[model samples]
Target: MNQLNKILVLNAGSSTLKYKLFNATNANKTLALAPMISGMVEIGEVSKVTHKSHGENPKKMELPDANLNDHRSALSLVIDLLCDPGFGGLASKSEINAIGHRVVHGAERFKNATLITKDLMAALEASIPLAPLHNPANILGIEVATELLGDACPQVAVFDTAYHSTMPASAYLYGLPYHLYKDHGVRRYGFHGTSHSFVAKKAAKHLGKPLEECNFITCHLGNGASITAIKNGKSIDTSMGLTPLEGLVMGTRSGDIDPAIPTFLNKQTGMSYAEIDSMLNKKSGLLGLSGDADIRNLQDRFRAGDKHADLTLEVFAHRVRKYIGAYLIQLSPRLDGIIFTGGIGENSWILRNKILKDLEHVGIVVDKSKNEVDLTSQIMSVESSKSQVPLLVVQTDEEKSIAEQTFQVVQG
Candidate 1:
């Protein structure tokens, strides 16, 4: 029997930890679409753990009474579940050859998947200020995994900002003092790079061209959204700046606002800086506009003739459309394709149609029939026959991308 290397991918959010276990080999072939085992642990007062195994007879179970109050306990429970005879794919934790973590901010130092060493951990710790909400959880996952899995099992840090490292100074720099960028790294470090890079590769494959030869615009429109202009498979520009809150209008995030709005609000409402920040990041966006953050609910409201929902949906579409127009100009003349991925981007055909409505004059014509389809698990071209550039919906797999990079780093 051929030996298979077990690679575990971990994405630790502020209050949740998600994991996937893939059986990999050093062969030049495609990895499996689904993982052998996948699970998530929600950490809180009443913690819970859910596990699922994929195969001929897939099984899923939930432990609502899990005693996981922190990331360490959460990950330890994940290890236990992975070794549980009936629910796990591994015989023991030692079978895990390498671990991959989704580190949110790599700053300017890491441009690719890096093998996690003591120095790398320190570097990641240094970047915590750049991603206060995300990096701590990611670092906690790495630390706990290292303590549990020991030094024998290699680990890799797959950064969310690595792919955007290819962005030029013209795109990344803010108009602030040059010293801010030189000393503090205060510039546009785009997020969702893993999804963008993964979908861009898929789109390039669908176009029958090498990624390096393709110039395209990729939109990753999830709860946290960002759009990128890819020139020759490299990110030349992106919407998100410095943080995930600067891009397209998202679930709860106020995408782009006047720079002085916060200060003005502080003066007017006497709210603290932290309070204003929380309101912008948590109380704004669709929720602030329409009183609801979920797009499906907002779509239903829009269909039911709610004027507020209508306006909110229009506002959301307008921002996305504006970015598409800007990126189109950035990759003009030789633009190959435009891609849509993420939850809302993949399923919300209404928003897609709204964004593409009057873009035909710019060669972006969407086929109504092709635009409306179930694209959750497959790739489809929604561009009309008359459209100059192909419009594709490519489902993103960041975990798979992380696993692949982790395997490569371990092999080397």
Candidate 2:
């Protein structure tokens, strides 16, 4: 078996890049981490890099008119940072045993973590239209890392859609004609599979049950969000559809709108399809509703009697509650717990309280005092005595999951 020395996981966005380097050792196909290095790079108009190694203070460096015009430049800078003798993660780029990439859309072709290759890259290129906003950047990150680290360090892809591959046709299919799905592959391929899968296993561990016996509804409520319905460790259904835009209301994407709205807008206002698409994906959601999308900012304003913020919070919580109710019915008597992860889910107790309100009839309750307290990953339970179903807040570590998956592929 190939023992992992160091693994670097990269999540590349349109104009931003984030990476985490793990100090890991693999034995018998299991991987565990030690102290590691992590960082992020902003690649837009103004570029910056934040690098942090274990036991060292995070250092934020402003690149001098940084030429972060592309993923290559950003990755080159990252390699340089990792090699800096002062506080870098490695003395040489060659020390990295493997690199794992977070590819947003794998479609139906890639159902699990895959080792990157020339043929794999060609297949990923065909998946671009499915995730126009994300997969290109993901591929670019992989390409740059491959060029920088060379073929000696194996590269793997941990796809966001892989875990949802188990969803049945009834769950993933849309009402559209069968040909659309058969010919175009236009079906619900959910995003955030990595986070959902990782947290589901974590929740299973926390509940002291084998993952194959646990059922859960995991809420990943970050800027880009999705909720997954897991039955016995497999994703039976998820919120997001063919794209990440189909699920719950997020920071910007408008989720679950009427199907006719796009044509309606085009006919009513003579707007192009592209314009309407951009509006729904970029200008809608909490931002479109109240002009602010960050839950923190909206919550603060909501507390201060801002009616718009109040409505936004109510709408957001309502959507989440709606899904939880549906998933509860879907999972039925076997429903184990409702998991909360991601930014808003983990940090905003007020939102959790709001979501859990009036859910007691369904055996889902939250201890008010317990919910208000500081709960780390080790102490994830927030279940109320009146509740039969547990309310867990698991701090998801997708980077770690990626590294472990990558290790497995490299080991094989």
Instruction: Say which candidate scores most in TM-score.
Output: 1
Q: What's the lDDT for all of these models?
A: 0.91, 0.88
What is candidate 1's local distance difference test score?
Answer: 0.91
How many angstroms is residue 265 displaced in model 1 relative to the true structure, after the best TM-score fit? 0.5
TM-score of decoy 2: 0.96
In model 2, how large is the Cα lDDT of residue 357?
91
TM-score of each: 0.97, 0.96
Q: Tell me the tens digit of each residue's lDDT in model 2 across 1-412.
A: 3464888899999999999888887666466776577888989767877777776565544455675778888999888888888768687988888899999999999999999999999999999989998989998899888888888889999999999999999999999999999998999999999999988998898889999999899999988888999998899999999999997999999999999999999999999999999999999999999998789999899889998898888888899989988998889787888999998888989889888998777788789988986556543788888889988999988998998898888878
Model 2: lDDT of residue 383: 88
Clashes of each: 0, 0
lDDT of 1 at 33: 36
lDDT at residue 113 of model 2 (Cα atoms):
99
